[model samples]
Target: MLPIKLENIKLNQQYKNREDYFKKMGEQLFSAGLVNEGYSTSIINREEIYPTGLATGEINIAIPHTDYQFSRTTDIFITVLKTPIAFFRMDEPEKTVEVSIIVQILFDNPEKQPDILKELMEIITNQRVLKEMIAAQEPKEVLQHFQINN
Candidate 1:
């Protein structure tokens, strides 16, 4: 099963920068025992070297993740920002994309995660799904989309 839970879904949060976003999200995940103590720093460092933002559709998205060493479980934390935040584009690191949705991935298995990653990519690129997720009022509204994928 895909590691998406109600507690992991956050909607309409605001953060000025990626660091602040990861810091707050990492705290929640760490408190849930899903990631290591250094998960935030690890993800932020990874982002600097390799950006996760993508222009999948009109509503751009970012998938920030770290090495399995920082992950305690195979889980995904999702957040829809209250306002769009500029994140460096993955394909073109020099460019920035305004992302409305952030999907933070945490997986303990490198070999097994690719399949789930592929599935998530499919979900990410779907314009209808993206719109539905963004328009969601509650956490369950966002959670349903992943549940359907699972």
Candidate 2:
């Protein structure tokens, strides 16, 4: 499993729209040398093509990300939104979304992506885990929750 470090995740700045938020967070990751220059565009385009917004009914979430080539390492950038952000639905193209958290994962190897996704899916599907993450105010707490849940 990948390292669950609080340093890898952060509280992103507020944005008027999803595009702005992605750009902002992407630049932060890029500046940290985590992702390539074109990573943001690649992720956004990927979302446009296949979509990553997953709806669990009770709490909607979006897993906006791209392949490993665009990143320098395998890590996850988690951002908790003070308010909801809009994203198009993955399964339902006609519908839009109000995502509370954005999990931007960077997989250094394609082989590890499946396992990471599976663990994340398990975490998201559990109401308790989701609630804990949403209520978490500190990065350490968030990392601890991830470790416990995963």
Q: What Cα-based lDDT does every candidate model obtain?
A: 0.89, 0.78
lDDT of 1 at 102: 94
Worst 10 residues of 1 by lDDT: 141-150
> Which regions in candidate 2 have their CA more than 4 angstroms from the true location?
none
Question: Which predicted model would earn the best TM-score?
Answer: 1
RMSD of each: 1.2, 1.7
User: Candidate 1: global Cα-lDDT?
Assistant: 0.89
Q: Mark the regions of model 1 whose C-alpha exceeds 4 Å error after superposition.
A: none
In the predicted model 2, the residue pairs found to clash are none
| Per-prediction TM-score | 0.94, 0.90
